[model samples]
Target chain A: MAKYLLLKHYRGAPAAVNDVPMDQWTPEEISAHVQYMNDFAARLEGTGEFVDAQALAPEGRWVRYDGEGRPPVTDGPFAETKDLIAGWMVIDVDSYERAVELAGELSAAPGAGGKPIHEWLEVRPFLTAPPTITE
Target chain B: MDEALLRSLTPSVLGILVRRGADFAAAEDAVQDALVEAVRVWPADPPRDPKGWLVTVAWRRFLDATRADAARRRREDLVDEEPAPGPAPAVDDTLQLYFLCAHPSLTPSSAVALTLRAVGGLTTRQIAQAYLVPEATMAQRISRAKRTVSGVRFDQPGDVATVLRVLYLVFNEGYSGDVDLAAEAIRLTRQLAAAIDHPEVAGLLALMLLHHARRATRTAPDGSLVPLAEQDRGRWDTASIAEGVEILQAALARDRLGEFQAQAAIAALHADAPTAEETDWVQIVEWYDELVRLTDSPVVRLNRAVAVGEADGPRAGLAALAALDDSLPRHAAVAAYLHERDGDLATAARLYAEAARKAPNLAERDHLTRQAARLNARRCR
Candidate 1:
């Protein structure tokens, strides 16, 4: 089985078909969106496809190595101002097609007015360890 | 009493119970109960025939379990056919057990967990601890696995390749918790080799032994990864090397030339060297060539590029690598190694850092990060 990461962007991604901001959506629509996302993860777990999923805070500072006996440098601009990652779900599935299908379903989570978001979720495969028998 | 000796008899004993008509789940549970009884009673009074003792005890447990459950009347039909057990039949059921555990229906994780529990004789708690999963999760996984294979007939032939894959997965897990999965894998593989006549089986056994021979030196005491070339050959297990080489020679003589045999040949070459400089890179590359021809997998090609670098030179290695995709795991690390060999330290350092950021596991990431840091420190001079 191959593992894939389905990435949701806060801003970098192209606009969704139902791209209303969460704050502007009706509270019922927001609840539906959250429920849809939760149900999707739960379904994946039941199918033994889920590896991990987490949301990012979208605010971080870049840190770098400084010379010995000196504090490390941390000076990048606010992470929130950039097109930052909102969340991601990692899934281990049988095939690339299956991964894509799951990602598509995830991207269809209800948005404003409780309608499909049609979001552009990034799907990236994880590099697996070499198998013992390649031949 | 010897715990390993007790565990070793587990699979055959379970096999006998299943062959005698106990359901797979019930048979496994009974065997576990019998193992527990052995641990409690054997220290005070050891049995002359441990296998016979376990068979007898476990069979009784199976009967008691079936008798207590009205729903298990399925076993009642076979009560008249109860085996008069002194020892299990001359026929080995261990191979069949391996096949059942690695049945095609189960997922790899389930197969692995089932094999460890039923074939490897590990407790759910022990398996859970080793895999870092909770006991309930592992128990559910194992039960699900057992249920999946329950319908498969005991006498049906199974794919040896699937069994080997499961064993190799176990071996690669190395040590976690108190269980040494690598050693356990070697034990199971050795058992499988004894049961089967396939060259690939022998080949897998040889590969495992060869890799295991150097396990002591694969990492420093602080748990840091050590590149193979930098490991102390003196720390290598000579006995395991000799055994592995002897096994590989026998399997090679079969001339089937399977993937595992080819891999073992590569491992044997590395083990043959007195020092890293003395390694036969030419022959190793030949083996990798054979591996690529057999599997045609990108991972094998990536490895072949490394062997090519050693056999030919860094430039030749880079040329070979050019044909491969950069997205492959370990691609960047291999490139970094080749670049360093070509005296392009800056590029090597940058690639090492990039690789570290993408590493799937913490240990590999730490190792790559250290490589970058080392190169950076040197450049500062």
Candidate 2:
């Protein structure tokens, strides 16, 4: 089995088909969306595929070292220019196709009008530790 | 209580229970129970016959569990015929356990977990810690592996290569939590070598020993990767290297060379050298040639190109590299090293940066980034 990260982007990805923002959605629709995502993760856990899931705050900053004994310099959140990550779910599935299927199901979470968001979720495979046999 | 002694006896004891017609999963569970009991009781009341004690205790636990399950009363007759516990055929039993744990039906991860638990005698919690997974996850994986292999006949001969691959995987995991998997792997491989007379087993043991000998030198105090050529040779474990060399020499003498044996020969040559500059690159290249013939793996060819660079010049190494697919992992890194050797700083720096982006692990990525940074700083100077 291989681990894949299903990334839900806050800003950088292309617009979803049901593109209404979360705040615009009816409270019931939002609840349904959250419920769907939770059920999906719970089902994966039952199947032993779930590794982890985490949501990120949209606000973030870039920090860099000033010098050996100096305080680090911090930059703006740069919301307009940055690719903001909303959240991520990590899955250990039997195949890439299975990861894709799960990601598709996650993308189908109910939106503003109780329709599928069909959001563009980025799926990235984690590079594994080098095998022992590698020279 | 000596935990090592307990762990060492685990496989043979479990094997005996299985041989006595206990289900693989049930027998394994019983053995774990016996081990826990031994730990609790052995400090105050140590057994004179540790193996016999474990078998008797574990077998009783298995039978108790079986009789307790009313539906499994059909197995009552089997449990009633408890074989007399005396001297066991420890060698065959241990080898079969290795085979069952590394069974082809199980996935690699499942096989690894099962091998570590059933064959290596590690607890599920310890294995979970080592793999950085939750205990429940590891427990499920292991139990699933046991169920998968339950139907297989215990007496069937197992493929040596599959067993070797699993041990190698364990060794590569290095150390985590309270378990030193590399040492554990070496212990298992050594045990396997004693049980079987295959030269490849000796080859794998030698390879592990030679690699493990340099483990301390392979990383810096700051947790940075130390390239092989830059490692402090004086810090290497001479005893391990000497033992590995002795084993390799013996395996090579057998004339039935395998991939592991050829790989060990290359490692032995490197260990033979007093200094990086004095390494026998020509002979190493020849060994690489042998390795290419044995496995024909692209990774081997990638490595062979590196050896070629050392033997002939960077240009010849580059030529050798050109024949291989560029998509192979570490191809760019190898090219970067060769370019740096050939004194093409610009190309080397660029390639090093590219390699860093595609590196499989954090340490290697950091090392490549530093290489690129070093060359760029030199150019500016």
Candidate 3:
């Protein structure tokens, strides 16, 4: 089986169909969305597709190499316009189509008014180790 | 008390339970339970007949499990009516166990995991630690694999080639965690050779021994990759080399001429050299020719080009390489080495950088990056 990552972006992605931010949603709707995400992960575990999932804080900075013997340079958190990764879930599935299908379902997690969010998700494949029998 | 002896008897004990009409998955679980009991009890109360003790304990566990399954109570009565087979025949089913574990229906990863557990007698926690996966994840993987193969019968003959491939995969993983998988692979291959009279099995064992004999010198103390030509021959294990050569000689005499035997012949030639300069490149090229005939694989052709370069010259090697697709793994690295030999330093440096970016492993990538840096530094000087 091959592993793929489903990425949720906080910024630098096209606007979703629902478009409302999580903070703007009603409390009932927020709970429904959380329940949907948890149910999705539990279902994948039952199907043996779930590998791992994680959420990232919305703040980060860049660091770069400096001249010899000097401390490395650092840059602060960028403006809201910058691309930010919100979180990701990794899944191991039998086919690329199955991965895409799962990603679509995850993107449909409930949003404001308890309707589909239709958010865009970036799917990336993990580069696997080379097989022993190349021949 | 004797761990190796207990482990070696695991497959035969498992085979006995399965032959007694126990399902493959349940029989394996029963054997594991028996092994746990042995580890707890055998130190103070070592049985005179180890195999008999294991068989009795494991079979009882299986019957107890089946007896608890209310749906199988009637079937258990029918099975209980028939007398168990004699000892020798039960032990002989070890070969069939290998066939069952390496059944074609299972994926390569699944087959390798199952073989280590059922045949090599390794614990699930040990296999998980070796592969660097979480224990629960590894358990799910193994149980899923067991369910996949639960329907297969043991009467069908298995392909020896597939079993050898699985063992080779295990060996390639080398040493990880507490378990040395390469040594485990050699042990399993030796067991298989004892069970079957096949030239290819002997060839695989010889190939593994020859390769492992050189493993100690393949990397530096700092864990950097050492090219074959640069390794210290003084550190090579002569005993292993001699054993590998002896096995290869016997297998070659059989005239089957399989791919593993041909590959082992190449490894033998490399081991035969007193020094890198004394290596018989011409003979190695001849063996590659034999390998090409045995398996017309692209990887073999790529390796043949390297041998041809050594036997003839860089230009000849590059000419041979020109026929293959440039997209192949290590193609750029090979081209870089040949170009450096031909005195095209600038091109060699550029190709080395490109190859470094494409390297599949961390060590190889670092080695290629250093090569590129060395060449660039030389040009500036």
Please report the candidate that would top lDDT against the real structure. Answer: 2
Candidate 2 chain B lowest-lDDT run of ten = B70-79
DockQ winner, 1 or 3: 3
Query: Compared with the true structure, what per-residue lDDT tens digits does model 3 show for residues A1-135?
Result: 567899999997789999998999999999999999999987776555677889999988889999999999999887754689999998866578889999999999999999999999999876553332221
The sequence of per-residue lDDT tens digits that candidate 2 reaches over residues A39-120 is 9877776555678899999998899999999999999978587588999998876678989999999999999889999999
lDDT of 3 by residue, B1-381 (tens): 788889889888998777777889999999999999999999999998899889888887877777777355555554464445345353477788888888888777677778999998888899867765545655676787789889888767888998988888788753357888888998999899999999999999999899889889887998787888898999999999999999999999999999999998899999999899899999999999999898998889999998888999999999999999999888999999989988999999999999998886667788899999999999999
TM-score of chain A, cand. 3: 0.93
Ten contiguous residues with the weakest lDDT in model 1 chain A: A126-135
Q: Which segments of candidate 3 are over 4 A away from where they belong?
A: A1-9, A12-51, A61-75, A80-83, A90-135, B71-91
Residue pair clashes in candidate 3: none
Number of the candidate with higher lDDT, 1 or 2? 2
lDDT of 3 at B108: 71
| lDDT (C-alpha) at residue B128 in model 3 | 68
lDDT-better candidate, 1 vs 3: 1
TM-score of each: 0.81, 0.90, 0.87
